[model samples]
Target: MKIVQSTWVRYHHIDLARELHEMGHLERIFTSLPWWKADKESREQHVPRGLITCNFLMEGVRRMGGKLPFYSKGTDAKLAVIHTKNYSKWIARNLPDCDAYIGISGSGLHAGKVAKSRGAGYIMDRGSSQIRHADRILREEHLKWNLPWNPVHPWLIENEEAEANEASLITVPSHFVKQTFIHQGTAPEKIRVVPYGVSLQEFHPVQTPPDNCFRLVFVGQFSLRKGVPYLLEAFKAFNHPNKELVVVGNVSDEIRPLINSIGTEHVKFVGIVPRAEVKRYLSTAHALVLPSIEEGLALVQAQAMACGCPVIATPNTGSETLFSNEKEGLIVEARNPKALAAAFTRIADDLDLRNEMSMACLERVKMLGGWRRYAEGMVAVAREAKALVLSTQ
Candidate 1:
């Protein structure tokens, strides 16, 4: 079961790649690095302004980082899988001979086209559906964050139709995502919901209130799609005297102005940090808030919960499958700063409730099964795809 895993974004790819490696199935990973880090190390030596002006540049940096190592390693694999539609296309020309292909998201089905051309069986990896979930977030944020009309809405609809019809197996992390595909015309038989698992060893809970300040953490891109602005707005109304919002990940230029306006006194931007450092931040936080407009099942949600930090997120975050409002964590309506603020206020005022949620968060991570289960499930899908290819041969 040799596997080539293509990671376009970050955590998801890292999670799957590491899990596969530990399971002895991972053969290679393709991805990129932070642009600023790249520029600092490259022969060019000049600082890249992308970090200061463009989210695409930031992502490009990560893609290039992911790609550089793979480029140097001679290509060899029995099976190649990609996490995104774009990566599938990029790997089509370079992919090694294999029995099957895997696409972790709907867009990734495009990789199946690449595999089909090479006489390989294609399997949909259903990571997240940007078409269905992303749009809802866009609509929610338009009102919540006072965003303008979305120009990308039409394109999202078109892609949803194309992707649903292309995949052989649609893999999802939650029923919410699977339903999104069904709504887009994919049959339920075609969709397989596999929960994205967390690494309990690395993400387990730690001593809270490590510092004097009550840290409310939000990890991920500071974009409307992430429901970042809404989180900021809600945090603004929090009125906590000794609290701080530690925002991790790179900031996009389009939203930087808004992030800055959110008030620097209470908000601290740590910028991009390595995957290893994320757990440390999660450990110190009082709570995790993901006011995302859309997501599959963000690994961060589970990571935070596993770290014993109760999560406060929206229904659309996909991790809501695990959250049992007032139980493991609180669920707020998407795009409502008022609701988000209210949830935070309650947690801020009640120490006992926060402690209970923290304990519940830890318990839920174990009951849901961790990364070991996730790896086994993904391997089964690969085996299925491989079998289908062999049967045809």
Candidate 2:
């Protein structure tokens, strides 16, 4: 079976394509990432450069636009729509004959339609919750937190919805993402839940945590959607003399003031570290805290687990799919700082439990394997989509 793929960026598609190509299923994959970066990633994965396409000019423009002084969230939203539409059109123009087309949600609506018109299946790969569901909940969260909120642009939402409606199959990384689509009126049968994988080669148990200091690390973008405020409140309330909270990733402008207003004791902000550094942080920390409000499967949870660091996250992050609650990690309700604080206290006070969870994390990664599982699921979904198209014809 031949399949074509497109991704707006690297994300997990490189690994997915690597596995697919090895299985002799990938026709070729298109990406809007710059040529240099894309080539480097493909080389790292042992994927031949001949099996990939890169739209470096458009990617360069998008990158530079984001760095402009006047660029706001509003502009970012507008550019997202423009970029997706142009990229989709470009993909359609260069389309090749294949059994099916698999495209990232917002970036391939036009190409999906073109592929379908040519008697090929179109699969929409969504890595987040439904666009409408995400926008609504994030808006409410911003209002609740009293932060300046720029709502999701309607065109972007409309485009994503159109992609979902037109595709032969919708593929998501987690059941949480699939449920969001169902809640937003999409048929459950149209969606497939394929959890993401972590690179066991890249992340592993490096060393055990040092005694006498309880370290908690929060990775990913530091913003309201990630439940940073709740983490801050919980961290302050944990009340340990030698406790440390390492805040990684970029802090948004709106969250900066609120972070300043809250507890700053023993908190370290090391923004935008390298991938190697991220693994190091996950490996050394006592536990990884991800209080995100909405996401597909957080690969970090697995990465942390692979590093022998148990996770403390909410259900919305698809943590349940990673490890059993209270076995390998803790799960607390979202927007509940008190509960998070309590989880912190529980893990902090128990030494044997910590070691047990760490061991459980390593075993879970052993079972998860890596991106090979995700690639197998995608191939199965691709065949189903092809079958659906041929049966209807």
Report every candidate's CA lDDT.
0.68, 0.89
lDDT of 2 by residue, 51-153 (tens): 8999866667767987898877777777777777888899999988999999998877888988888888999999888999999999999898788788878
Clashing pairs counted in every model = 16, 0
Error of 1 at 221 (Å): 1.7
Deviating ranges (above 4 Å) for candidate 2: none
Q: Can you give the TM-score per candidate against the true fold?
A: 0.75, 0.97
Per-residue lDDT tens digits for candidate 1, residues 1-393, read: 765554444545556655676677765444444544334423232222221111233345444554665642112111111223344455555555555555444334455677656665566565665465556656666665565634443443555456556655566787667777777667888767778888787777555665566789989888877887778888888887788989899886667777777766688899999877898899889889998767778779989988999899887778667668899889889888999999888998888999999889888888878876887887787777666655666
lDDT for 370 in candidate 1 is 80
Task: Report the number of the highest-lDDT candidate.
Answer: 2
Least well predicted 10-residue stretch by lDDT in candidate 1:
73-82
- Deviation in Å, model 1, residue 362 alpha carbon: 1.7
Between which residue pairs do clashes occur in model 2?
Answer: none
Q: Model 2: how large is the Cα RMSD against the reference? A: 1.4
